[model samples]
Target: MNSRDDFTEATKIKLLALAANLCSRCRVMTVGPTHSGDQRNSIGVAAHICGAASGPGSKRYDPNQTTEQRKHYDNGIWLCYSCSKLIDNEETFHDANRLKTMKANHLAYASTLVGVALMAPFEVKNEIRAGIIEATLALCGSGAGKLDLTAVLEGYEDHLKSIDPNYEVEITTTNRKVRYDITAKEGFVPSISIIPSAETRSLLFEKFENLRLTGEDIVIPSEGIDFVGIDIFQELKKTNPKSVIILKSKKHKIESELFLESDKGIFSLGSFQSLLKGGKRVQDYSGRALNGLFQYNFIVDLENEKGTMEFGSTIASWIGKKLLDIKHLPKLLKAHKFLEQTSSYKFTVECEIGNTTLKIPKGIQNQPENVLYFFRRNIKALYLLNEISKTLPIKVSIISPVTTDNSIEIADFSLLLASKPQPERLEPGTLLFNSRLDELPTPLAIDLWCQRENLYLSVTEQYNRTSDLYGNLISFPRWNFGFENFTPVLYSSIDENDRNYIFVNIYSNENTTVAFGLENGNFELL
Candidate 1:
């Protein structure tokens, strides 16, 4: 009864190509060259949107589906191994309808490569052109040799002319040396010249024995650009502000800078020159930066592989009316010598290994008096770190010190734990418990502080000063809370009782206030 219906080989191939060999969910490239550099490696899986079997217990099972329909191309979505298993286990979140939407979104993103960058500058377009040249060079193997250009021109002529009407190809030879040049009439297409290696020339000579290299230019009547190279990174030069460019080149190396042109002016996203220095190719990379706001610095030196990423930022917030709730408010307000600026906070984050450094914009103001609100605003940095840890070993360090300055130091302590923690199990009735902390293998010997009036929470991984790497990259566990930040409105005075209690008002469909008393480093529901 549980007989599985599987996709055809053709369908599987189409699924991978349509998604551009990227997982629909995480958008990580699934196909790449293996370590041997000769064979290809594919981590892609043609996942079933609906259950493959007609069994009642099968996830997202549709009993009405026929065997052919169950195995049809439309029923499949390409995903990585981890994402495929994740969707199956989390059936509710990854329903068939949601998976279909994800498939459509991925296809749409892939289509943008051709649709958007069609008008990019000719010189910039040649980056893609260079990839094809490299691929063709590989076809001929190693060594400098002559290659026939007739078939290659005939195949791509029509497509090239689509981008520029004057597109033409010319192949000539002088003294046994071949010169292959692609040119356009005037501004239509810029002249392109690339000397094929000896091996490429040999293979081309064999492929087209009748073809001869002459001293005069041999022009081919073709007008087009090679769109085949757009799939190199599945992205184009003029990407949207929120777009992320992962280094998934067939060559696995970047030799130029990535930039963006906007109405304001041209701005540099970052450079990839250092990524390919020392003859190393980027083997694996994952992160999200270049989001139109921050300056990016990425270094993917796999050979040396030893470095640290440090990100520092200053935080400032206006001291609002809530200051009246503090115990020393009356005295502080009377002696308010520093009326210009209310508060300033500073902190730094250090990681052992990262592809890039993420900058947090300085002087964030008018923030809600919620401890979690700060984390929410900078969650992207955490996500970037998490993604990098998937392919590289990393350790996190957070440092914030309290000095005898007028500004209040919100950062008094740091929590060092795994970047990726186990599913946090909440102790019963704990209103505010560090869910991820309970799964620690050993008891953490660190100071813990919690204040209600001026909320501050600093959570970081444990700092053991050891070489051992901790944490596996996994999806953060869902929190049982609403999007609106929760704020503690009322608190029992510490002078009144040994056990201090606070009531937090959480916003949701209906406003609800929950009471909690501090106990054993956790806030228990009172």
Candidate 2:
């Protein structure tokens, strides 16, 4: 049946961020403010501009309306808890015409403030540009603000040693400034100089006035802490950054192909020379338009002045967002809301189950037996995540030891089967069957992302029309094996999206009915 009551991932995110997650009716959140960062601070609900249901509560549900007209961005409003609740008290108050007017007016007010955000002073714009870089680093799932300079440097040095112990990269930090001392012979000195204070950073910029260096000479303008990445043996083609390997901190291991993921306005080796260069006036922004600001920055800012009228740390928040302070990172629906810790790379998530909320930590979900439990508890969130996954892939694997040894990682599936667990493979009531094959479908082991030719795993779902509890016909029961590092590489939309699959029922026995696809391998097809 056709329905107009659904919101796409993109539309929902737009309504929340643009509304600054504020309530529309009262212009005040009765439960709490957006500052607290708690999902509990979720007093602002994205109400349908027209009613979404045809039942008792719906005031303007149109059964004949087309999908586009019903779910359009204009068909939504951000309202606070009190207003959202009261609108239904008197059905006529929230009539379609009245609600539409409120949305239009609220957005117009938000637009004026964004005009200033876009045309912020030169100093402030620089801060925003810097924020983009810092945000990318934070995407590595680590506490990036208070960086471990020594650890980052050492990781780079170790990578260099692997190239050749004789090849050297030395790192030293003094007075909050960091310098990479790469002792090269025969006059070709590799240098990575991190300038701290504005005076020195400017002085260094002056030196680059007429000089342009190769990608080897990366002059990263200091945002704070030194960034040396998976730099060794990377594609020196320089134009396209493949992946980076930064050294790990003595205490924390930094692992991810973060900088490699290609996306729009996401990653760039942006120049900071604009700050150093003279003669550029803050253009005439007298028009004072929000759309102009949005188009200019290519970023969505959901801040409003009303929310700031009642704040003690607005200055601090501004500084952090402007500068690349870890504390005041950009809050978008795209980013993960993991738990905080004093010092750790991974983050825990707080999710409610039934009436009780539980903290789902990283280490806990990675366990084989606990995988089902995690999926069962967070089914709704995971479903939303899967929907959102169309835009951004959700990487749950840990790139640790099980994947470090490349030779072992690419081994045939049959060879690695002995090391895997062989217990109650199927849930108690799971249906099982066995069918003989003409030939053993070559015991192949592919990466998590391999060029495969299948979708909708051919087993349980095809027969019973029932995917596992998580709705995933194929999944990695455990992420810390050869399969952890694999990702399905799909070149075109037409190609199959499945990867890292292993056929399980073929290997199941009466005693060990592993119908759950419990057996783990790099192949995604089960």
Tell me each candidate's TM-score: 0.25, 0.21
lDDT of 2 by residue, 318-363 (tens): 2212112223123211331221111112212232324654232212
Ten-residue stretch with the least lDDT total in model 1: 407-416
Model 1 compared with the native: what TM-score?
Answer: 0.25
RMSD values, in order shown? 26.9, 30.0
* Model 1 misplaced stretches (Cα beyond 4 Å): 32-40, 64-69, 114-327, 332-526
**How do the residues 1-526 of candidate 1 rate in per-residue lDDT, one tens digit apiece?**
5379999899999999998777999988789899989998988999889889865657888888899999999999999999988888899988989998999999999887654533335766676566545543432233224454333433333433444455454434455343434443555533333233454555434422322211112222111111232221111111112222221112123333333222333334343322222223222222222231222223333455433222222222211212123233232232222221324322211222347543221122222234322422333222332233333333332212222211111111101112212323333333442332223222221111132222222233332111111122222211222122123223334566523443332122222222221112211111
lDDT assessment of candidate 2? 0.37
Against the true structure, whose TM-score is highest? Answer: 1
lDDT (0 to 1) per candidate = 0.41, 0.37
Separately for all candidates shown, the number of backbone clashes (residues 3 or more apart, or on different chains) is: 18, 21
What is residue 519's positional error in candidate 1, in angstroms? Answer: 47
